[model samples]
Target: LTVTMRQRPSFVVVGEVRGAEAFTVFQAMSIGRYVFATFHADDIETFIHRMESKPINIPRNLMLTLDVVIILSNLSSDRGSLRRIKTVSEITGQDQLTSEIVVNNAFTWNSVTDTNPYSGFSYVLKRIAEKEGKFEADLEKEVDIRSKILDKMIEKQITNYKEFYNLVNLFYKDRVRLFETLDMTEEVLM
Candidate 1:
């Protein structure tokens, strides 16, 4: 396996391995390799089921190596709010009794408190900043920028999470256009 890595293939993407391959994949990841894969299940139990009864036969301990799991769900509602729900989860380790996952609270959602469109985003930014070792200013700046953006969003009467999310994505993706369209002052974005 080490010898294979010497070539550094165009890309080494593993396609949802469930058995012994899980051990190999975990070993590779632990050795500082990159993997971008999707799981059939959103939570830990589904993962366990696949491992315990799969052609690949994955070992329980091997699952601990996974660092991230992105959960994507569809609301399937006519009201059409938060249609593309993306929840990013990072695996810390296993629990003692249940022996399931222990998400490190890097960031999370509070259904009760996230009544506002701009909600829990600071926590997400904090986690990213923490990972990048740029926590000193990144988090604060993100919050300040987001707060300003939220003020403008509210002024524009944007309320739904979906619309707010799109606006945020668009603003970041095309900053010049958003600045021109929204007439965002230099003081707010900088």
Candidate 2:
């Protein structure tokens, strides 16, 4: 896979580089290909701390593979405004240690204080409910159930990695055809 990518460089977006995929991802980036990837890095310290922790398991040899490390924070600004970003970072693997990554603040977002009664997160689900299809109602029901479950989870304390991992592994029922059915991809991971 790495050789094939090197032979034909292409833009790749990885959802998360949490496991052994980190090695190949690093090699591909080092070899020159436009790659945009994000792990659970919320801050530089968090990123550094995490690289030194488990689940990330980034090999020491492949540590400085990224050309950029964009950090996202959900912190509210001092001005009582919510902040979101399409931030940018330039990764320099020059110095081994004591090298601080540079971040360029590209954009900021305003907070939504008042609720517009017309808005909700279940728009897609609502549309699916209205649509006439074999699993249309099932999709809507699933979305609603998921939303409720997520809300309940959010109300509770932080979820452990094992719990989330179990959820992911369990949710991926018949993943072999899930992608093909969505017309996203026909290839199976395994």
Candidate 3:
């Protein structure tokens, strides 16, 4: 971890955060480096409890640096076993009185519909909007547009990572052209 930090990378990824490594991960996040790591926990509450106790013992104050937590779960169904994102939660802050981490679930999966619906307001999105000098509504529109593009990709069976990466880059380079090619329109924003 120290060697990687010396290289000054923009992002750091750990397969799984366990034991003392959690400290270093939080340290990297504290210094503004985006750290992505998978931790074993059934839910956000359990995750917090575990982190604040035992061998990990991550300080509750340090947990404030975490921006988001995406929980994935595997489920078995008539269609067989599949993995789905259970929740996408943003760590808003720590409660002043209780000192407990405040998390906002931006998206959550509905088992009945098998869809991950956006829960409306998102502190993470708001922060991003402020940083980019754009309205939160504009960012929401962008997310909707991108979601449509991804749906189109899935329909066309563009599952390969390289293909998805290249097409996403193209969208970034010329969004109008990409929309035209995908038979989509900016009308969704309206």
Candidate 4:
């Protein structure tokens, strides 16, 4: 991780975080580098416990540098097995009195509905809005637009990774042209 950080990359990704390596991951995050790593834990509570305990021992204060945790779960049902995102949680801060990490769950899986539903609040989006000097509503609108584009891609069976990547890049470079090619209108973004 130290060697890679020297390159000053925009973000760092670790396939899996285990043992003392988690310290380096948190250190990278402490320095304002975005870090994406998978840690094996049954749930958010377990994740926090493990990280705070021996082997990992991430300091409570340093934990503030961590932004989000996404949990994926595998479920078996009548329709066979499916892997789905179980939770999307944001680390807001530490409790002032107890010094415990405060997490806000922005999205959670609904097994009954077999869908991930937004919790109607997101500190992460609020932070992004503040950083970008935009209203939270504006960011929400952008999310809606992007969601529509992704849905359109799935509907059209454009599942190839390369194709999806190029199309997403095109959306950033020539949004109007991409919308036209996708038979969509900017009005839909409203």
Estimated TM-score for each candidate: 0.53, 0.41, 0.94, 0.93
Q: Report the C-alpha lDDT of model 3 over 1-190, residue by residue, as the tens digit.
A: 8789889999998998878888888889999999989999988888888888889999987888999999999999999999999999999998889877999999999999998999989999999999999999989988988889988887888989998888899898998777777776655435
Each candidate's root-mean-square deviation in Å?
6.9, 14.9, 1.5, 1.6
Q: What does candidate 2's lDDT look like per residue over 17-80, in tens digits?
A: 6776666677777676667777776656577557746766665445556545656656655667
Candidate 1 TM-score, C-alpha based: 0.53
Write candidate 4's Cα lDDT for 123-183 as tens digits.
Answer: 9999999999999988887887887888788789998999999999999999998888788
lDDT of 2 at 148: 45
Number of the predicted model whose lDDT against the real structure is largest: 3
Candidate 2 off by > 4 Å:
1-7, 75-83, 94-190
lDDT of candidate model 3 versus the reference: 0.89
Pairs that clash in candidate 1: 19-56, 19-57, 20-56
1 against 2, candidate with superior lDDT: 1
Tell me the whole-model lDDT of each prediction, alpha carbons only.
0.61, 0.52, 0.89, 0.88
Residue 163 CA displacement from its true place in model 2, Å: 41
Give the runs in model 1 whose Cα sits over 4 Å from its true position: 1-6, 9-23, 79-83, 96-98, 104-133, 136-190
Lowest summed lDDT over 10 consecutive residues: which window, candidate 4? Answer: 181-190
* Candidate that beats the other on lDDT, 1 or 4, i.e. the better one: 4
Ranking, lDDT, top scorer first: 3, 4, 1, 2
What's the lDDT of the predicted structure labeled candidate 4? 0.88
